[model samples]
Target: MQFLGAINFSLPLLASATETADSSMVLAAVLLSLVVIYLASKVGGELSNRFGLPPVLGELVSGVVVGVSVLHLLVFSEGGTDSNLIITFLQGTAGLSPDAAAGVFAAQSEVISVLAELGVIILLFEIGLESNLKDLMAVGIQASVVAVVGVVVPFTAGTVGLMTLFGIDALPAIFAGAALTATSIGITSKVLSELGRLSSREGQIILGAAVIDDVLGIIVLAVVASLAKDGAVDVSKVVYLIISASGFLLGAIALGNFFNKSFVAIADKLKTRGELVIPAFIFAFVMAYLAAAIQLEAILGAFAAGLVLEETDKRKELQKQVIPIADMLVPIFFVTVGAKTDLGVLNPAIPSNREGLIMATFLILVAIFGKVITGFVVFGQPGINRLAIGVGMIPRGEVGLVFLGIGSSIGILSKPLEAAIIMMVILTTFLAPPLLRIVFPDSEAVGVASELILNTSGTPLAVESPTAINSKSNDAANPEATPDGH
Candidate 1:
């Protein structure tokens, strides 16, 4: 604890000479928090890796250890508009009104949260940049098959089990089942990358299915939320939600692809030598913002941006720039996830929370069986572990969190149900990578720390010269730019 507070090197020179700390001190505090966060992330990841576990799990545990849950380093202050945790550990805020601390609290939490969100966007962007639409399309039908099965089976099981076995309300049960349907591409992709399987056929299939599952999951969430909040789901409202979600993906890709050459030409005319990254980030954030505006996940926009860029030769280089940023930010996101989990609620011995414990156990069991069945959809082939793919899909990742948040905000998902669903997410996430290790005994998941584990399905993303930009411009000028890119 003393070592963590000793990070005074980041303090502003002007603030150090003062008798009092100001907002600059808050800036220093935030920076110090990241310092501590990064250090904890590394230590936890190193320890986890030594034991042959996925470092992601370790990074998450680091969050719990360093965050409000254990370390006393940071804690979320209830009803404060300021920093999320006390910075007395870094610098004292003596003689200030309680309200003055609100700004400090808000600043730290907001900044770190934005960075963590950016981490996931970068992670998805790298995945998209490595991927080709053609490969996603090749397995499109089969992926759709698996996605439909994954959603339906889980939703049915969750709803029925809650209604019959657990005797929960239809609304909460539906939410519980809804939580089960997500495949958490983030977690699955990381494990596949660790195992050196991201480019393999099986990995591609899982990725494809997970993407579709996200779309279906969003639509399901919308319909279910409507049923919970409005007392009836409107068909027109459901149609609009589906169109909005699907249209965001299809429209973003269409607009991005159509204007790709013109945009590249403009950038080349500027002659910045910055290649694909500038345009890559622009499209990613723009599409991500647009997706959120239209009510879909921002990562969806990032992934679509990757697919659009994958068409060009700029992918490998674009991926190269994206991974480092993702690596830094992604760990913080996972750590925050761990830190935010109220470990106190996990105990079943607490008399009041016993119902929650039982419900969570039931949901966890159902969620696993629901996703595990989808892996059985694979064709019989050598080296394709059907069980491994199913286990890979089990982790619910951010998508499950989104569902829980929406349910809570809408006044439907109760405390006990929320606890139950959160437990399912944590358990599924912790259990997936280890299970994958057992299933893939030949996995190269343990080595290659710095490897980006990117998609090998596309061309290298090199900087385009003036001539190439002009050639692309000419191709666009012609009326023959096919949808198929042939």
Candidate 2:
């Protein structure tokens, strides 16, 4: 009987050892993923710099190469058998049963979702920080018209095209079109900045339109999310979403304005040495949280916060501190996104329920044409080049990918669909730099606009110069003024 007891105790010990080994294997897989992501990002950054392309384009392409549809370096390797193995290992590490593993996978997917959310937020924040409200205001009217047309036209076209050609469901087609509405300003800004045209009139219009695009995109996303939950489009819910979104925007702007004054006062009072960097971060987080509570994106809040503080004396100091943190955390978000993709899944030989090639091609076309046609909507402006503007809006960057990832996670899109969306993002991003170079060869002469300045009453003001005034007066009073200001 004592010998039997000893055997029972030994059996438990052996089982524990096996469990420990499984945990170790899970940890090893995660570590490998990290290493691969880091290396791929580095290689991409270098190549982009060498090719005079945006670094983000390189990073995204690198991800595609490592993703499921391509080289199969990671993620969906060996026909998704590897992904299943990794998921299984992760499940075992969490002490989950097979049934519980599914739950765990669902929960872990949230982490990726949150990272994607944060990535877009930070990206928008950077765009906001770099934005000049005055410049946006200068082009506000034209830009708003263009932004609306840009969104409406492609959306209508995409909806019609998908329904007519593919006969896909209406909701899915709408969702796909909605996905295309976002203009990744980060890539555009990067390209413009590199070409020394960020301050130009055309650039300013694009930036302003992009800001509006982001706001509209979020509204569309919320509407789509609501429709997905309800299983049909609810006009009442959409109305409510629009009202809430408008309120959120107004509240953000008001709160940011209020906080800007109060925080500046507090910072002035503190007068601590070393630039009071902590306050800016505190402001960023608080505004971000506030925005989230109001059902707006945190990045919008961050951007609003930046916009509010743009004119303050401490603006440079605040940017200097916040940018470093953004720089570090933002790339982790992108690299992780890249790492999650499984390039090997694209193979036609995969015998599964996945719709690989057709879906990918459709998505790619949707992503491309949606932004491309927006260039033609420019009107009443003689010197403005709409083609350059459209090309500038091409890159999907963090925002588009975030939308794709979210749709994928919620079962709105299948894995192959997710891969296809990612391909669209990568291709669009790759096309931006070279296309912009060709379109805006003399980028320096482009005269980029920076910000849209709104008066205290919330009305946008145009920058009228003495030359413009004199020319107008001369045109009315003296024909000679046309040649030289009278």
Candidate 3:
């Protein structure tokens, strides 16, 4: 009896030890993933800069190089980690058993995904800090028009064209159309900042319009998603989304001054090292949570928080403090976006993929032309780079993927349709940075000067090329800078 009791106790101890080791391996996996992500971001960014393109493009390309499409250094759970180098390394060197490998990869992927979400939140918040709320307001009407046109044009054309040309069903066509409406504000804003035009007249209009486009896109997504799920539109749910999104943005701005003062007061009382930024982040996170609770994107809340806080006396100091944190987190978002994309859909050799390739060509044209026309519709901005404004709205990036994921989950999209949307997103995303540079050639000469850093006076300063800054001081000196100086 005593020998049996001893055996039982040892079994429990062995199980507990195994659990502990698995936990440690998860952390190690996350750490190694970060190492790979950081290296990819930096190397890609540097090479992009060298080639006279935005560093963001480089980061994305680097992500592709390391992701499932290429080296398989960074992959997710969706396609399985059978070919993932990181998982293989863990199995080989960390003594991770085959049984535990799947669980570890899943946990690791979830952690990275969460971190990437946080990275975008920080990126939006930082953009808001750099933007002037009043300027955004000034361009509100023109922006509203642009946004409406952007949504209506592509959505109508894409939906109608698909049904007519490809003989697709109404529901799947609508889903694809809806995907074209949202401009990925995160991607466009970063490129604008990099080009030193974030405060320009056209830039303000694009920013204001993009924000509106996001709200509209979300509402469309909700309606279509409801329809896809139940085969009928939920009228009340659509109403709630519209009202809630509009109210959240308006309410946040209305309450800005009060919240700004309260934030500053809280910062004043604290003598701790991170007194300013810590409180600021707390407010941002709370606002983000509230936005999500209302069925809006969390990044919108962070952006709203940044807009409110920008009115405070501590704006510059807050920007300075937030930079380092953004540097660490934001690349995770960008690189993860790049890594998640599977470029295998582009190949035309496979008989099944040939249809997707043809359909993708059509979607690409519609996506580009639909957005490009929105710029021409903007009234009263004389000599404005209409092309840039339209081009700015082109890249669908992560937002397009969300639509694709939902449609795929519901089994609404056929194979060719799904691949077509993916191709549209990939091409538009990769094309925007270089296209922005092409349209704004003057800005390209002084693009490096656009990166913001702190001077001795504790105010944000833009370094410039001697000749370029002389002729374009106003635009070059625009205070809206990106985190990590990209």
RMSD of each: 10.3, 12.2, 8.6
Model 3 per-residue lDDT tens digits across residues 1-486: 000010011334434434644878888888999999999998998899788888889988999899989999889776544677898899999899988887677767767777888888888888888787887998899999999999999999999989999999999999999888878888888877776667677778889999999889888888999999999999999999999989999998998857878888889999989999988899899999998787788889999898899889899889889888888888888898899888999888877679888888888999999999999999976667799999999998878988888899899999889999999999999999899888877764343454453321123434342333335453544345433333
Ranking by lDDT: 3, 1, 2
Error of 2 at 428 (Å): 2.4
Per residue, candidate 2 scores C-alpha lDDT tens digits across 1-486 of 000010011334434433444444434544545455557777986687577655555666676666554544445221223344445655566554665443333333333334445654555565565556666666788777767776786667766776787676777677666666777765676556545445456677787777677667766777776776677667775677567656765675566555666777888788566445677656667777876676666666677666666656666556556565555455545554454554454566774314646766776676666676776776765656688878877776556655664565566765555555666665666677778877875432222122222211112212222233224221232222111000
lDDT agreement with native, every candidate? 0.67, 0.57, 0.81
Model 2 CA RMSD to the hidden true structure, in angstroms: 12.2
Scored by lDDT, model 1 comes in at 0.67
Number of the top lDDT candidate: 3
Order of candidate numbers by TM-score, starting with the best: 3, 1, 2
Q: Compared with the true structure, what per-residue lDDT tens digits does model 1 show for residues 1-486?
A: 000100111224323422233566557666877887788888987787788776767777887787665774544433122234456644354443454455455455555666666767777777787666776776677677778888999889888998998778988888888888877787677666655556555667788888888888877877888888898988887798788877876786687567767766665666565555677788789877877677677888888888887776555566667665666777766776666555666877776468888888888888898888887876543445678768878887656776787787788877788888878877887788788777766444222222233421122211212222224322322232111100
Give per-model TM-scores. 0.82, 0.71, 0.90
TM-score of 1: 0.82
The weakest ten consecutive residues by lDDT in model 3 span: 1-10
- What TM-score does candidate 2 reach? 0.71
